[model samples]
Target: MKQLFYFGLAQAKACIFPIIIFLTLAVTKIIDIPFLHRYDLILLVCIITQMLMLALKLETMDELKVIGVFHLIGLALEIYKVHMGSWSYPEEAFTKFLGVPLYSGFMYASVASYMCQAWRRLDLKLVKWPPTWIVMFLSAAIYFNFYTHHFILDFRWLLKLLTIILFYHTFVYFTVRKRTYAKPLSLSFILIGFFIWVAENIATFLGAWSYPNQQRQWEIVHFGKVSSWLLLVIVSFLIVAMLKHLKQTKGNLH
Candidate 1:
């Protein structure tokens, strides 16, 4: 029970920035700020919060680097997606480019931040990990499909199959109170994807961004998005895995 509590606590600690951002956005609708736009306020709050986390030693410099990479990657995707009419930020803000608030990139950084923190807190290790080149290739292909699907055939299903084949033998080892537990890496991807899907629902409900269907009336985001999240989680995982040098060796933990 104590182990479980600590495990939960670690997860909560990882999510601190995202939860705070979500709550702040939710309240912005209710509170009338005379001069500041909601989007600008959100940007300010997210930046200050990130600085505080670093200053307080809640996040390390190395972790900040990983988060920074995600921010840029996310921002690039946001520009492409918004251009392709994927979804939209339906608000006016000076910090926005092509309708995406600069702060929107931080949302993706939050996922990377959580993954980095959780890996350290849980002492995670990878077993039977695929080769780096293959993982990188697949990650690139997966990201490319997100954009090319609009112009060409969507290969998400095929890519997902490749992901399962590549990682089927991979295992994630994590510690809880000095007792280590292992799970299939694919399962971890799915579980994380599901949780992100839930978070997405909450984000949409809070008016962070909205789909065309959502603009008419709020409804549950289609379940198919979970697949997209699962792929994204795999992408995030690979980047962190590479950064941490988590490669499988012949002498495996048993």
Candidate 2:
């Protein structure tokens, strides 16, 4: 029972930023602010949330660096996806670049923040992790497929197979309270992907960004997006794993 409480608390802490952003979005819709746009308000809220997390020691400097890396990565992807007409930020804001709001990166950073916090709070570790080079290659390929799919054949299924082959034998061990539990690494990716897909639906409902199909009215995001989120989860997991030197025990299954 105590373990469940701690686990829930940790999850809540991980979601603090996302929850705040969601609430801010909901509030902005009802309250008309002449000076501050919704995007600008979101940017401010994210920045303040980040600062508060640091001030309260909820996030460490090393974790902050990881979040920073995700910020740049997510922003680059946003710019490309927007250019490719995959999705779009329709709102105007001073912090936007090429129609991508700066706060959009925080959405990605929040995932890293959750992973880092969960790693620490849950005392998580990887076993039988794959080589860093292979993981890096898979990450790059997964990212590339997001763009190359428009110009060439989509190899996402191939990449997905590679991901499974690389990490199917791996496991993640995490503690809740004094007890420890383990899960297959690939399963963890799928679970997180599902949750992120749900969150994406909520985000779109709140007008964070819109798919081409959603411009007319809000609709449930396609279930197919869960696969994309699964790939992205692997990318985010690899980045966090590399930072923690998890690849050192590549073949140590025990």
True-structure RMSD for candidate 2: 3.0
**Alpha carbon lDDT of each predicted model:** 0.89, 0.89
Q: Per-residue lDDT of 82-151 in model 2, one digit per residue for the tens?
A: 9989999998899999889999999999999999988888888898878889888888899888878989
Local accuracy of candidate 1 as per-residue lDDT tens digits, 64-109? 9999999999999999999888899998888998779999999999
Candidates in order, TM-scores: namely 0.94, 0.94
Off by over 4 Å in 1: 246-254
Cα displacement (Å) at residue 146, model 2? 1.3
Q: What is the C-alpha RMSD of each candidate to the true structure, in Å?
A: 3.1, 3.0
